[model samples]
Target chain A: MDEFELIKKITPSSLSHREVEIGIGDDAAVYESKAGYEEIVCVDTMVDGVHFLSSHSSPGDIGYKALAVNISDIAAMGGYPKFYLVSLAIPSGWNESAIETMYEEMNKLAKLYKMDLIGGDTVSTNGPLVITVTVIGEIEKGKVCLRSHAQPGDVVFVTGELGSSSAGLALLLEKISTKDEGLAQYLIERHKRPKPQIEAGLICSHYERVALNDISDGLANELNEIAVASRVSIDIYQNMIPKHAELHKLHTEWEKFVLFGGEDFELVGTISSQDWERFAQECADHQVSVTQIGQVSQESDIKVFLLSGQNRVPLEKKGYQHFK
Target chain B: MDEFELIKKITPSSLSHREVEIGIGDDAAVYESKAGYEEIVCVDTMVDGVHFLSSHSSPGDIGYKALAVNISDIAAMGGYPKFYLVSLAIPSGWNESAIETMYEEMNKLAKLYKMDLIGGDTVSTNGPLVITVTVIGEIEKGKVCLRSHAQPGDVVFVTGELGSSSAGLALLLEKISTKDEGLAQYLIERHKRPKPQIEAGLICSHYERVALNDISDGLANELNEIAVASRVSIDIYQNMIPKHAELHKLHTEWEKFVLFGGEDFELVGTISSQDWERFAQECADHQVSVTQIGQVSQESDIKVFLLSGQNRVPLEKKGYQHFK
Candidate 1:
């Protein structure tokens, strides 16, 4: 495919200079940096095989998910996603329509986030398709929550149940059949259009929440992240963990699916003991799912205890790695 | 061949940030978007054949250029680049050291710009190597110059001479022997390490320039851009066009090189006829190479005249196109 033409299609249509000083078609674009506000930035990449399969979703879903995952990174930092720049590398000989359809979906979703497509690049690759997005956000001064602030007694909470994306992957991989039409749709949507907890992040930005992260690497892998970053220990109770009942009933390897499979763009954050009630009230007001699954302690090792058994289990890094 | 290891090797050492709400390893990276400033954002990509020679340049040069080119775009808009995010696609068989070398160069330059390495993604590609960088900058209010403001009776000016980069590329490709050391080095530097005209842009931003664009696509192409954007006609006096005497002595096709062969990252701008003296003064103060080449008229066609033995010949598009 011709690279620039591919770009002209996927380019965000909002080229107005209202807030922008300079639009595209230049060496660089210019924007007014409001003097008093903080600037937030994040980036993400999606490979054809590692991040998605051609059989799993539509071009629109791929575009939306690429933008969403980048936004989720910003959300995890307690920021509102503002602007985005996308870069794509697709193999040559692909029909031009594939690139155009991807852009149509991406631009539509970009408008939904109220983020401008300021600038990016495009090129032809001989390998599988690769899409990368760098998203910039804005947050107030002293309001951004980081991943190293968790104290010894903070409670770990997660929004939404896990295993839906994993189930969706199984549907794509094994061609698993779902008896319920709605269940099949839910699994697919969960897998394809995993929403970033942007609003929750905005709310948590003000509170001195314990260590924070997004559930991109599954619960166990991400929990190990907080434990390492905060230099503290985590103890996740197996019974307290929230799993989709439908997923558990439909899948034989329920625990493995729930614990290790990734692509769940949920906000897994920690809050101080004093702010637990506030967090609860806020989640209730917003009608968001916030499940208390664990707590931070002074211990050196991260442990996961099963309610059905009397033993504790050490956490593992089952999160996805590019070469592994 | 392992993507993560390649990334780690290329990744620059990060700084301690109390302001980074969430650093890398999340769905998105959140930054402190300071208030009272409007944010500036831009992105650019470099494909192997279109932008560079894989055999001539190292991975480090590729990564550095990925960032530097985007920064140049922002500088052309009179903004201060502060953060950079890059996306790369490489063949799976590429060694990890190549990736590390690229990141090391990018990280070195990022520190030079005082810009943060916020976040980005990597993926395997079967096609040519590709690097895309998204850069964010800040501009104070009332300072951004745009390409749509030129009007009739505006004086057109360009920074530096034309055909340096063209000659440089020719020297590399045609394997020519040059007698002038400085000229040859100048051409090569123009090709390999283009210096963005940030100082000139800054000076012009405070003036009443009608329109401005960088000359990455040659003078005629840029003038055509001004003519189209401002809906005004431009007529460049053939004698006013700047050329290096060494180019004429060395090559028989000097006119073609000067006219259409691009890759000159100079600044082309328009000013009110009355401001010509002031423009010259600014150039002198900054020790910037600028020449008055043309003027805008009430009509909209762009014309180029030849000064050969009193014969006048209009020039054509001597610039690059997507397909070519």
Candidate 2:
């Protein structure tokens, strides 16, 4: 199918409310905020090679992931995403069904998060697919979160198991543990569909967490960012780091994958020590794992130590490097 | 200079603003709104081949156009943009100073408009250069402008000349027009730096114009949209279209460049006929040319007539095809 056919098929049944003065199929989309909350504006670019592979990722996966990543960004800021405008550049002859699938998954997620798909520009180019989705979310007055408030003595926590995306990628690339039908499908899903920790972020924000950030660049690099931004140090207990047990069955270097693997898209946020117990209960209610991996300190460097083992290593910028 | 050097040079002296909880070099730039207005959000994408070309546009031009385009989206809805988040995908090993130059132009425009550069994502990509800018604006309730509000008798007006961009492109591609260096420069500048009519949009909204839109696509196409949305028709005078004298001197063939050529980035909005004089003077005070080119009609088909030639032609759906 052609692009238009695909767009028509996948265009959501509900794309606008009275608040959306104008929707898609124009130079831009125009939306209004009836709630009167300040707009939480964000733009994310998903390019071929750097963010996703056209060969490996399906069209629905691309569409879904594009919106999913932007939603995750909104989640990181402790805001409820309200609307999205997508700017897409895809190769000519892009399949209509594939495009529909992409929008279907994207629509599913948007409905799940209560954010509206408002406006954006769409064009075709003679190059790799480039999808940029900008989402606007809202937070109660004076309730928006940031990443620079991780005070000394705050506890650093992450939601969900790390190293899954890295493990999934390794399983696909190396073929050491995958090619088996069920396992391959599982790994592929892990890499393509990122679970946004919106509920946990909202709960944390309500409790006035010290700081928060999403870990798209793996643990070490994210911690480095929080430490640098907040001017604090961390001593992460390696044994306390959560890892998917099934991943260890596929890869030998579990620690390396957990530390430097990319595309995890989990929340690696900080909270005050007093709020840790309540956060734990909230995560429990949400059925997502919450692991306290480290503590904030007034010291200098970020360090990693194994509680069970004596080995300790100072991390030097581990995780995804876009240019390198 | 390289990318790193470029970033260092254009970090913006003395910080962006106090509302930015975190600026560049973090997961995301955090913003806090203090103006107490509701949030309005929009995003735009410009690709090298689809939106521009490096041989035709430099980094600074691309950057300025990038911001201007997104701001225009906000203007379409009668909103004042406040903050922008930019994302770029440039070929690795490209000019470093070019990125810095782009940022310099962006900050200059941002400061001029009282908007802050809050956050953005940058990465090296194998594909052609892609720049996506997302803007957040604030709007008063019931004042958000839209294209669906046009009435049958509303006067259709446009700001600035129509075919300068197409005329400019023609000169560039033909190369012979370079003989007139000053004229060539004027056309090229118009093409590269098409200004967004933000202030005019605000004033029009305050006066409650019947309808509004920006002329990124050709005038014929934009009018068709307003017509379809309002379930009415527009009668435009062929002679009333404001085209540059230089463009008329340079081109002999109509070829629909004036009628269908796009990227003018000017305001193509409408108001009641009674308000035409007041609207024109209001636009004059802002130093923007506002000329009535058409009138809304109850008829369903748009009719473009040359009263002098005693000729009438139905406007065809000829303009930039999004999927093509």
Candidate 3:
């Protein structure tokens, strides 16, 4: 089928929100801006063989993860995702049925967030498939959680456990083997479908002077970003890092995965100690476990350190680096 | 260099607009919405081999065209271009200096329209280079010109000439030869840099009940879209269609280029006869030549026809279609 025909087949007939003035068929999509709210815009691209392997990931998983990563950026800004535009560069070998299933999977996640698929472009590529998603979100004025807002004496907290995604990726790649079939399946699912911590981000927005960053580039790299942006040093207790019980039981070197591996769509941020108590309590009510693993320091070196027992060492910002 | 360092090198340190609260360094960019205006969003992707040849086009031309096409979409909707996010999947062979030149060229066009460089992604790809640009624009409430607004007795209009870009591409690709060196250079420049008719679109926004579409696909394809969307018939005099003076002198299949060739980036739409006089005058004042080429009919069947001499024929919707 042609690009127009494919678009017609996948375009949603009705939008869930009344704010959308124009949808897929127009030259551009129009949406009404809410009063007292600012818009957050982010665009992310995932390439086959770079972000995902066609042999390893199902079309659904590829589509789902592509949108999920973009949504996580919105979540990190403590915004409500309202609309998204997806541009796909499909390879010649991809079938119409596979493309339809990809859009179907993406739409399932969009429904959960009440996001309308507004506009995009679909072009044929001579190389690998590329998917680019641009999400438009909204947040109350002055409620945005910026990474540069962290202050000394603030407690750094992370939502959910780290290293699970990386471990799952390793399992998928067969870099490590586990006899526990259930554990392997669970980790694989985690790698394929990561949950963005939007609720936790909303909680951070409620509190004052909180700095937030999403953990897409491992705990060390994310914390280093927060430190550099906020111009403050951070010290984290190595023993306090959270890990899944099944992951902890593995004999593998899980510390490297937790500290240096990437693609864990969890929120890592800092709030004042006083605010952390209430923030942690609020997150608990949502069935999300918030763990305090570090504290911001008055040092101006913009460094992150691991407090392991009686010694402190620099935490290297090591993770996935494209074009390195 | 890694992704973060590359971003730091290219990210504009100062944004031109005060509305941009967060710029390139954040997980997502935040901008305040203007009161009494709605948001218009559009995205377009261009692949290396499919959209433009790497050997034939410079890095600057590729970047500038990628952004210009997306801005044209905003112009078609009668919106003021504001911010744009660019996501580039760079091939491994591309050097850092080439990438920097690309951004520099894109920024030059962004400055012309007062658009801010917002958030985006840059990653290494094992495939061909891909560039996806999402532009966010704004229009006064209720001023959006949709393709469905055409009515009977309306006059169809187009800004600038058609087919120049396609002719230019032909010259660049050596598919056609011309004796006029100056004409060849002009066509080549036109192909590399097609201007978006934002001023003409703004003029259309001031009038009531106008239907607008950009001529990215050939004039025939674009007018067909308007007719299909508005459920009306459009009849145009073949002699009234505009063409560049140099292109008119070509002995090749220039008629086919004007009717079915793509990538003109001109604005085509319909305005009420009463509104046309004032709209044309205002566009003339802005140094834009607006030509009335056709008239909308009351026919219930959606179709487009060309009036050539004494005979009339259906205008076939033939233009660029991926995966054809």
Candidate 4:
């Protein structure tokens, strides 16, 4: 099919948002921004092999994960993503069905996030497939979260578990044994389809004296960021970090996964100690699992301590580095 | 440098916009949307070898053109190009100087257009360098232009000239005669550094009976798009199209460059004959060159008439298609 024909066939009619005045089929998409709110914009790119492998992931998962990662950015900022633009570059010989499936999956996630797929460009590539998604979101004025707001004596908390995604990646590469099919599948799913802590982030934003960030890199790196940006030291207990039970079953060096692996898509934040009890109660009421792992200090350095027998080592501040 | 370090170094210290509440370094950038206006979003991508070659273009032109093309989209919509997000995928072995040079060039253009380089992600690619720019613009509520709004009797107009970009590409590729060095350089600059017709589009938007589009895919393809979208036929006088005189001197197939070449970044719009005099005066006041090339007709077919001695042929509609 020609570009116009393919676009018409794939574009969903009437993306269910009154604010979206124009979606596709225009030089640019138009939308109305809600009153008394600040608009948040975030963009991310996923290149084949570097971000995902077609050999291990389905077309839908790739599409879903691409949007999901950007959503995690908005979630971290305490905003609700409302519209997105996707630029896709596909290599030759790729079947049309796969491209259609990718868009279908993105549409499903867009509806789930209450966002409209506004507009973007599609072109052919001779290299790896590249997908870039730019998300526009909004939050109530003065209610947005930032990494540079953690104060000394703030209690550090993390939502959900970490390390599973890294473990999942290892399993996919066959670097770790996959004898237990159930454990292998669980880890792989964690790596492929991550759930962004959107609700938890929104809930955390309502409280005063809180700073938030999403754990795209491992928890250690995120904590360090909060420390550096806010000019406060962070000290976390290694035993307090939540990790999937399957991670230990598959990898002996699971600590590396928990501390240095990337792509968890969980929220890490700091709340004042006085508000910890209230925050914990609210998390419980919302059915979100949040664990207080550490505390912010006046010292200008981050430290991770382990209490486990024979493994009581201070963790290094290293995380995933794309370039050497 | 690592991704984080590079981001910190490349990110501007502050963008001088009161609406920009937060710039780079956050998970997402934040800005206040002006009241009584609609936000317009556009995105475009450039791939190495497909869009331009490092051998033929400078690093700075590559960056400038990447953003320039997206600006053309906003210009077509008669919007103010205010903010932009750029996602870049750079292959290994690319030094920091080249990346910095690219950003410097983009910032120069951004300053010219009064746009802020808000936020985006960068990743290391094992493949070719890929740059995707997402532009956020604004237009007065209900004042945005559309291709489907052309009236049957409206006269078609185009800003600046066409075929220069394609002819420029031909010179760069060494496919055409290079004896005229100055002409070759001018055409190459047209290809490398296209100026988006932002002023002309904004002037045209003031009129009630006007429809607009940017000529990115040559004159013929843009005319066909307007015809199909507005459900009217377009009849054009081939001799009326504004082309670089040097293009005629370079090649025998000059008509193909004017009709089928893409990447002109000039505005194409239709204005009612009643408003033609006033519109032309306004364009002249703005120092923007515009030419009347065609008229919309009742018949549902686009025809281009070329009058030559014993040779009158209706032009075929063809443009640059990424995939055959």
Which candidate number would show the highest lDDT if scored against the true structure?
Answer: 3
Candidate 4, residues B1-324, lDDT tens digits: the string is: 477777877688767678998888889999998999999999999988788887778889999999999999999998889998889988886788888888889999988878889998888777788999999999888888888888878888999999998888888887887687888889989999999888998897798867888888877777777776787777777788899876787888898888888888898889999999899999999899999987886765555444444555665568774223
Query: What's each prediction's TM-score?
Result: 0.89, 0.92, 0.98, 0.95
Superposition error at A102 for model 2 (Å): 1.6
TM-score comparison, 1 vs 3, better candidate: 3
Clashing pairs in 3: none
Clashes of each: 42, 1, 0, 0
Please name the candidate that would achieve the greatest TM-score relative to the true structure. Answer: 3
Per-residue C-alpha lDDT of model 2 across residues B189-257, encoded as one tens digit per residue: 877887888887787777665577787778877787777666777778888998876566676664366
After TM-score superposition, the amount by which residue B197's alpha carbon in candidate 1 deviates from its true location, in angstroms, is 2.0
Order candidates by lDDT, high to low.
Answer: 3, 4, 2, 1
Native contacts matched by each model? 0.68, 0.41, 0.91, 0.79
Write down the lDDT of every candidate, Cα atoms only: 0.72, 0.73, 0.89, 0.85
- Tens-place lDDT digits, model 3, residues A1-324: 478788898899888889889999989999899999999999999998888888999999999999999899999998888898999999989998899889999999999999889989988898999999999999999999999999999999998988888888888888887999999998888889999888888888888788999888899999999998999999999889898887866646888878876888999999998888888889999898899998998888889999998999999888754213
Model 1 lDDT per residue over A1-324, tens place: 655466556555665336665555554555654444566777777777767875567778898899888888778878787677777776665567877878778777777668877776676655667788877777776677777777778888888888788777777675466788788788878889898888888888878654678887788888777776677787777778787778777767777767777778887878898999888799879988889988887676544333335867677766754224
Candidate 3: segments with Cα more than 4 A from true spot = A321-324, B321-324
Report how far residue A91 has shifted in candidate 4, in Å: 1.4
> Which runs in model 2 stand beyond 4 Å of their true positions?
A1-11, A15-18, A25-27, A32-37, A178-184, A298-308, A321-324, B1-26, B29-38, B175-178, B298-308, B320-324
* Clashes (candidate 4): 0
* Chain B TM-score of every predicted model: 0.86, 0.89, 0.97, 0.95
Interface RMSD of each: 2.9, 2.8, 0.6, 0.8
Candidate 1 vs candidate 3: the DockQ winner is 3
Q: Candidate 2 or 4, higher lDDT?
A: 4
**In model 2, how well does chain A match by TM-score?**
0.89
